[model samples]
Target chain A: MRRFSWFNATSLTLGFAFLYMPMVILIIYSFNESKLVTVWAGFSTKWYGELLQNEAFLSAAWVTAKVAVASSTIATVLGTMAAYVLVRAGRFRGRTLFSGMIYAPLVMPEVITGLSLLLLFIGIGLDRGVMTIILAHTTFSMCYVSVVVSSRLVSFDRSLEEAALDLGCSPFEAFRLVTLPIIAPAVISGWLLAFTLSLDDLVIASFTSGPSATTLPIKIFSAVRLGVSPEINALSTIMIGIVTVGVITASLISKRASLRLQAEEQAAART
Target chain B: MRRLLLISVPYLWLLALFLVPFFIVLKISLSDTALAIPPYTPTLDLGAGWAGLKGFFAELDLENFWFLTTDDLYWKAYLSSVWIALFSTLLTLIVGYPIAYGMAQAREEWRPTLMMLVILPFWTSFLIRVYSWMGILSQEGVLNQFLMWSGVISDPLMILNTNTAVYIGIVYTYLPFMILPIYAALEKLDISLIEAAEDLGCSRFQAFWLVTVPLSKNGIIAGCFLVFIPALGEFVIPSLLGGSQTLMIGKVLWEEFFNNRDWPVASAVAVILLLILIIPIILFQRNEQKQREAEG
Candidate 1:
């Protein structure tokens, strides 16, 4: 182990504070009893109760849930197949183009993507609703799912699947017996990532959704313009809790994998 | 045949939905801004038998493209968005680099906690995070209140309804983007390079400036591009924080399409924005390809 110092420890503290202070305030304020925001009248769960009573928000949450589940499942299946082809085939024409097209929406200015999609929908005379939202969400999300599953498939030792094939199993049967179980984690991770993205999305969903199909972000957006109420803070706080847990879990898993790699490297050096 | 079938499905979906939408935008940009649904009818000869702008739609005139070029407001919005995005990206790099550096130094157990903290904001709704800053920086908000309480000022600061607010919002939202990529590069860096620099009669600060900064450039560039492009088209952070005083091209485009119901000009603006965005992307891809070939 390397020598530690006050300077290094202090910076870590400061970094964590910078990252989490706003969220801390949000969670704290969620329990504040004041109807008027920014005032800490007292601590209470009144607003969380109020959040429970919001039928519209509940219904909006339901819509967002439907979109997330539907879109993420579709994205996971499509993305996994694409990933398998790109990695297993070793080479293919137009794979890069396909990857680029799928991923473009991921980083493209949402304004451009959203506007273009909106224009397309309106031009085609398609009604803006759940279907449009699902389509737009799935397009970008498939990229993430594909990347996750594909990266895992890339480094995987192929001999295991080949052995299963040699033992009188067909390619499909061998894959079901071997690769499927191994790559299942990647599929789950991709599904989770897509689910969160679809849940948290506002910009694309806004353009594609009709009046009857507002998501949570749209609801919070419209209500926020009215004023800062504790209800908004409460919702934000709950969202922060879920995402914080997810990010921590992902980081731990990745770090553990790297550590395992390092241990193997050290063992090889000894030999 | 199985491989081909696997490939074609995603390809067709992208062609039908993703690529086609941009084509639709391109087609609309070519038409006159006459609020046409599917965009028919060219410019009218008002003097002869008043119809639409047949002159505008004519390939010879290129009237709509010319109009976007000459429009001062459109150009100003474009310029302002670019400048602001530049500043925000630069700011995020400055702040995020140090934090990433410090994280790279932490113990293995501690690094994940730190990374989780960085990505925590990502899990929440982006709009809500931007909205939360509204509470923090508003006139009666925490920032102004702290300033007043500490006698930093007698009155509340006019920080909310200005470009300053937009800057704050952009930096707040995008700092994560800059930090994550930089951290990835820095974390993967071999630490002995620093020792190598130190062994060569370099001080710690000098070692970092000499070795670390150059090593982190690719990540910095990727982070900056990620932040800058999105910052270019950001509507929510600017509008919510800057309020009505902010006239970003995004808002301008939104107004033309939704409020003004002028699809043609709106499409023109979208085309222009897409053109601007595509420049960086093509350049980045080409550079990455070059780097790959050099390594190969």
Candidate 2:
């Protein structure tokens, strides 16, 4: 008769604690005045201030942003196309091959992807930098985008597109007027996912990045490798802060949108 | 023309950037090592026509693959990577399944927030999460300090730079991958089915074992592969948290490339790793295909 069992409650609590405890500790200790990470010598915002002044970290952040923006945009476009082709392009030659490439990157190890792309650049005598990094990120992240968009495409109403085409809309116009609008949300989500994947990447960036194209993750990894610094903790806390705000805002917006849609549906039913 | 253009956009992008690069890695895996810029001989310089192709073919050999066979360390690193990855996948599933099931059964309003928490860490920098563990598990880290302060132990534990830390890091990082898929499967389960089973004299535990476990098998498999594949090639976690003693294939590939500057052997390691992963990759794709067919 118990709905929320004690077992489930315990597991959820323990799992969440396990997940968040380390991050919480890291964030709290980032505020410590002491240079030593373990011993607290009163709280201060000095680490955050120091982080802002660190030119290397700032440049890395800038480079990361640039690569993320570029790669995600490119990935979204190509991925949407790929998803549409897979869903609509009937009996296309080499369909198996196309789908294989799409799914391969989703499960491909970052190390292998990184190494392969690095070798490709070297084989062709191309320079390694932000551009090459963008290429590498786009190659991997497009698989994610395709997966997201294709799921949406699968459940989409075919009649809507048929009606648009029957009403004298060209095929492209039918797609633009009907299909694209409906799938826009999925595509947007795909783009955001790709953006984060690019932003969060370390191995691929490290492999492909040349001089003057260090990413935030690469820089952070090097710093952490050398030793744990309070500044790194401060930076991580800020990153967590940004992610929390973004996720909250996204969920709220989606919740409101779904509620509005339900209300509209109810009104339509009443009429 | 439009269809062609639409298809070719992604197809060509992937062909150029993804597929071609893999072939290049395959090619590089065969070539000999060098000390010059680019650091490998017998470049596949196709622009130079047939003569260049002939030269490239002439320089290619199985030397790097042979080198891998001769080195015991490479074999150990690879076997250890697979061993660690498999165990961690099981661990992630054990820790993640209950949380995912709880989230599925939670109030509809609460489910989204719970899912968001699972995904939020994924959005944060992966390296930072690994770095957070370094702080917790180090000899003089917060964990040891707390235990010492509480009089739990007189001496600090050597948790960092060990295989245990690697497992902890992998499980922590990849837990969401296990959770999300299982939650997706569990969320779609019909409450009526469980009720039906209960009415048939099946206890709740039996109902769960017979009904839930059987139903969620696909998700479990998918989630395991999701955790296992990347965990196999996880360079960052092993390198950052694990010591030199932890011999993961990723770390070995990295050392061979950067420290030894042996691109051919590194590529060979990667090629072998990919060959090993191909089985799981194929199985994952087939599972996805079966799901799609079922949905249709």
Candidate number achieving the greatest TM-score relative to the actual structure: 2
Evaluated against the true structure, the overall lDDT of model 2 is 0.90
Model 1: per-residue Cα lDDT over B162-269, one tens digit each: 889898888888888888888887887888888889999999889889998988777788788878878888888887888676768887887776687777788788
TM-score of chain A of each: 0.87, 0.95
Q: Which stretches of candidate 1 lie over 4 Å from their true place?
A: A1-6, A90-93, A246-271, B35-61, B286-296
Best by lDDT: 2
Clashes in model 2: which pairs? Answer: none
The backbone clash count of each candidate, in order, is 8, 0
**On residues B1-296, what C-alpha lDDT tens digit does candidate 2 reach at each position?**
98899989899988998899898889889998888877889766789999998988988999999999898998998899999999999999999999988888887878878888898888877888999998899998999999999999999999999999999999999999999999999988888888899899999899999988888888898899999999998999999899979999988888888789989899999999999999888888789889979987
Instruction: Give per-model TM-scores.
Output: 0.89, 0.95
Q: What is the overall TM-score of model 1 with all chains considered together?
A: 0.89
User: How big an interface RMSD has model 1?
Assistant: 2.2
CA deviation > 4 Å runs, candidate 2: A259-271, B45-52, B191-207, B291-296
